[model samples]
Target chain A: MTTASRATRNATSRPGGRSARVRDQVLEAVQAELADTGYDGLTIDGVAARSGVHRTTIYRRWKTVAGLLVDLLEAGVDDTWAPADTGSLEADLVALNREVREALSGDSSVTLAVIAASFRTPEAAEALTRFWDDRYERSAVVVERAITRGEVPGDTAAARVVMAATSPLYHQLVLRRSRMSRAEADQYARDSAAAAIAGLLRH
Target chain B: MTTASRATRNATSRPGGRSARVRDQVLEAVQAELADTGYDGLTIDGVAARSGVHRTTIYRRWKTVAGLLVDLLEAGVDDTWAPADTGSLEADLVALNREVREALSGDSSVTLAVIAASFRTPEAAEALTRFWDDRYERSAVVVERAITRGEVPGDTAAARVVMAATSPLYHQLVLRRSRMSRAEADQYARDSAAAAIAGLLRH
Candidate 1:
């Protein structure tokens, strides 16, 4: 679950216990450090100081920088979006498009930094792959729902269709150094759904 | 012009010219250095030593690491492919796809390393932007040719069509850490053309 829900759960089950508080503080500190200093500049001592947590505790729980970042990314993957159960496939894909656009555009540089780091190291690569896999799996539900509603073919590759809708945005943001306007994102969504309807994403 | 054509021109016009030879060696050294030790580890001194050219000449001509790389990348942008005017839009887009796939898969890691570096530095960012713009311009011709041949609509965005055909391969290679076969490339081409023909790419 996302930190917001996790916090809610902590309040009900444990009433602001020390361990839950520590975890919240540490993760908050990590987010701040990632924003301020970026991935390369972050250090355990800095995080410990910022979080008011002990170095031993941080090291014992997270073995390396990659480990910490991986956990942070995993924590980020908790689903905050669901496919629009709208009557039409076009509208549902557009809803899915906006969800992805908002998520990436928030703290865009920080997200890009983590992605760039993934290219340089195997540990980071694995973590980033897992993060993307989680996203694709979540987005795939949208396609599956559309299929079940009889809006698309049963044998369509859900993730591939999702990738078709979103890859252009990612490409523009990361490599082309451009932002995807809402209009552009909507167009991409519509085009990708049209392609799926044309049976391009069939299994 | 690309290195090969530049070398050929130099040989015929000014045979065995020292300046042309020096230019060739310096760029060759840069490529080797980029492959052996990534962008961060490369140094002018190392390139100068490897190329057997004076440090002063290297500094005077290229000035900085980014300068050398930018020049090298620009040299790589010379036109080498033409859209197969095979009277079928499907054949033309497929041909364009193979060109991109070959260029990218040749030194995939090195290309990604440069792209990753772009996110961190302004100089690298400019070079990478130019590199992509050149590729897009070159490929846009394919779409334009198809339009002239009355294959696609006049209002279709040529570069966007090209981006559709190639962006997934880039996403898979760089972010998803996946390999793409020739079959996959061909499929992407066909799907993108199908989308365009359906009027999805029309402006």
Candidate 2:
């Protein structure tokens, strides 16, 4: 197994492990701290005190605050919702947008904080990139399926379509300081997908 | 005049004033460094050396490296392009999208670095917000004009349309690891604008 895979196994395994419960508790504490204090405010001692885990155990598992946060973000990153095979690219995109909007609007304070932290640290950036890339990968599958079904042109760039469908959510989150509502996000997704499909057909 | 306004005046008034030339050289040096080295590689000392200005002069004007970058970004931020009076929202939006696409596709290295830097610094974020808001303000005029011409609903969310028009560029710049070409950008702008216009009209 790769180092990351081994780390994941170590994090989740509990059979005959004395530190299993401690790891779980520490992870939960990190999540709570992220929600309560954001990235900059998270601390190792705080996690230890909250989780009743020894500070040494926490340090042993994760070297820095950012490392702990990376673990938390990785643990909490949800699998992308299954893309609706709604027969129309527009409908599929709307469903995708709804899922994204829900996540963006949800109280995923820990996720947001970790995402913000990614900008400051290369380690965090790599972690966050993996997290985002996973989501993009899932969304790309949906667009690819649409193209295969002739909902969009065969030559349509799935990457471009996905980017068009989801870019507004990131823009609202990072630039506009606004939460993307479900209705608005769905509309954006549907319209953007429709437009991209139309362009693909035309070209 | 406000302090910033006064500073602007002082910086621009003299052909060879120490402050004026130093600020100009610093801004130019920052832009050049950004183009050549990206954001992570930028440094104030390097900029001072490149511009042949005293480090103290740069420090006096901008308190930190982030502050200096903010000023440079603000300097390059463009006001809204002319609104289309084409008697149709579709045409106006298309024109607006074209202008944005041109700006984004041209000299994108500087803009991309600024955007990446914004994620790292609050001052940079403020500057980015102002830059986007300026574009939004200009697009709002076009939307309002479209409403006046009975091409779009009077209550259409002009801000959202403006965002939709530009969001693809942001996605391509940060999420994708490729430079968006002008041709692709133009097609995206046209299709996105059409889609937004169609959605607006449907409502």
Candidate 3:
């Protein structure tokens, strides 16, 4: 969940208490440090200072930098995140791709940080794989809704379709390491939606 | 170019001299080390030890591990490798994607090694960007051939079409950090080809 939403929830449910708040601040600090200085600059002491959490508590709880990263990904997976439904496959896929584009854009993105971290750490790689798997499954709702609307074939491979819609954005941002105009990013979503409507994407 | 090709060229040309041979061996050692140990383990000492190219020579020439990586990427850009011509748009794309899949599939892929390196070092990232830009330009021959053969519409965006065809492979491997069956990998190529044919990928 976003920090704002998590804080609002904490306000509503005081019983979640100091433990939940501590996890939230610590993870937020980790994200900030990673975004500010990247994977190599990430350190347990940096996180402790930034989060105002004691070093002993952090070391006792998370143990290592990789441990903090895995917890961050796990928290994202456990959050109530889902794709926005727009009543049509094309619109829905566009919405999904837009989120992806926004997440990966700007200077020192947290998404890019964690992704780059996965390249360096085996535990981070495993956590990132699980994170993408959960994300793909959740995004499959777009295709399922499309099938229900009769916009796409019933046997359409949901995960593949989602991958098609979002991969171009990641391709430009991460693989190619470049930027694109927002219009160009949206075109990728359009292409995937059109391909699905043409029945080209199937199991 | 492959080492075999570079060796053959050096043999037939003979003008490359000892300097060229030194460069080739040093870069090859860098690739092997990065593949085996990844970015964090990459060091000038390891490269010098493996290459037998004197640490003094390495420091005088490449300077740092990042410098060595940048030179390796430049060599690839300078090579004469081109996509094959299978006549049809889909077949040509399949051939291209097949090459990409092969490059990234192996456990110690130089392709994956350098790609992952780009995340850790700024110089490597810049060189990788140039590498992809050069690659996309070269691969556009596939779209040019298709346009001439009446397969795809005129004014079809060559780079975008190429990116559409190949981005999914990078996505599955780098972004998602997962494996797919060969059949599944080919399906992404087919999707892009079908999209281009439908004029959905028009600029």
Candidate 4:
């Protein structure tokens, strides 16, 4: 998996070129198949046909349905995406959780589809793990800035703070399958921030 | 789904009777099928063959594979299972989270099977929702006792605390597919408990 991930990283060296364009077209097709028919219906042939790329190329690179999903997840780790500087940990967390809520909502949520795919494939699960690890790293800056401003202790584990803030949204929407309200979603952010402020999330 | 659930409740009245025996047999078969080959491989005909319960009776009562799964979850709400009286909220939560980790750990985890089933079918989702509602009610006693012991605020949302304690384990194991250690698993229980003690998870 690391070798495949490394290959994916190397592929990024050719941004906005022919290889990148092909990758985009194929991943778009993967999402369409997942949205319309889910993981059970996704196939290399289908993806190749839909993307107008040859199946030989998909097989040589992706090798499996999981390959396309892994690359799709790699594409999700956008360099431009970051949490807003809300000047308060709680407010920022509220904003972050709301973003997660937006991702999980709707009938044909691509994030939900990806999550469902991960449940069915080990490679997809690994890709999702890497994706979240990157996300946690990106979001940890919120707590670092809070520490600079004297909002939370320097010893606070920033990733745990992010996990507390976002875990509840996934808990309610994904695991519980409940129709969680915005207020309910926001409270979890407050909970994590309050916990961090109290020095309970210390390393 | 509610009507089907209602029918399931009615079937429970005749405890240890013929109907009860048939349910036990069919549900046992459902677990077997789910463990051996997940939701995609499950079929009413397969259950009929495995359980030796007539197919007509299964079709009449259970109606679908989801029906069998719903009853299987109902059967899991055992009267004998209760959190240990560890005499502290954090410890009790650790005990509870440990139990969840155990359920989700094994190679052929039936809880995982049921969770996967929930993602594929609306009825299974409803059944799982009801199942967790019951578990939450049962687990809430730990929080109530904590309030009485003055370990946390009187207005603490016990279920939210429970969700906090458990959600991280699910997030890491199911979503991230990370192999979390028992110590790592225990930390989340502590995290949730600390948040509650800080008066953060207030209703």
> Candidate 2 chain A, which ten residues in sequence have the lowest lDDT sum?
A1-10
Q: Rank candidates, DockQ, best first.
A: 3, 4, 1, 2
Note the residue pairs that clash in candidate 1: none
Q: Per-model TM-score of chain A alone? A: 0.79, 0.77, 0.91, 0.84
* Clashing pairs counted in every model: 0, 0, 0, 0
lDDT of 2 by residue, A1-203 (tens): 00111223445554546666666677778777777777777899999999898899888889899888677557534322346678778887887777656545544455556656765677777776666666677667777777787777777777667777788887776544566667878877776676666754244
- TM-score for each candidate, following the candidate numbering: 0.84, 0.69, 0.91, 0.83
Tens-digit lDDT track of model 1 for B92-113: 7787667656645644245655
Candidate 1 deviant stretches above 4 angstroms: A1-21, A77-87, A106-108, B1-20, B77-87, B106-109
lDDT digits (tens) for residues B13-92 of candidate 3: 34587998888788778877877887678899999999999999999999898999888888777777788888898988
At residue B103, give the lDDT of candidate 4.
72
> How do the candidates score on chain B by TM-score?
0.79, 0.72, 0.90, 0.84
- What DockQ does candidate 1 score? 0.61
Q: What stretches of model 2 exceed 4 Å from their correct place?
A: A1-23, A76-95, A105-108, A140-161, A176-183, A193-203, B1-19, B35-44, B77-108, B139-162, B175-187, B193-203
Considering lDDT, where higher is better, how would the candidates rank from best to worst?
A: 3, 4, 1, 2
Candidate 4 residue-wise lDDT, A83-141, digit = tens:
87899999999988888888787666667877877777778888788988777788999
Ranking 1 against 3 by DockQ, winner: 3
Highest TM-score, which number? 3
Please give, for residues A1-203, the per-residue lDDT of candidate 1 as tens digits: 11211212232344457876776677667767776777778788988999999989999998777777776666555435345677776787787777656645645345665676675667777777777776677668778877888878999888678878888877777777767899888988898888787777787
Cα lDDT for residue B140, model 1?
78
List-wise, what DockQ does each model earn?
A: 0.61, 0.33, 0.78, 0.63
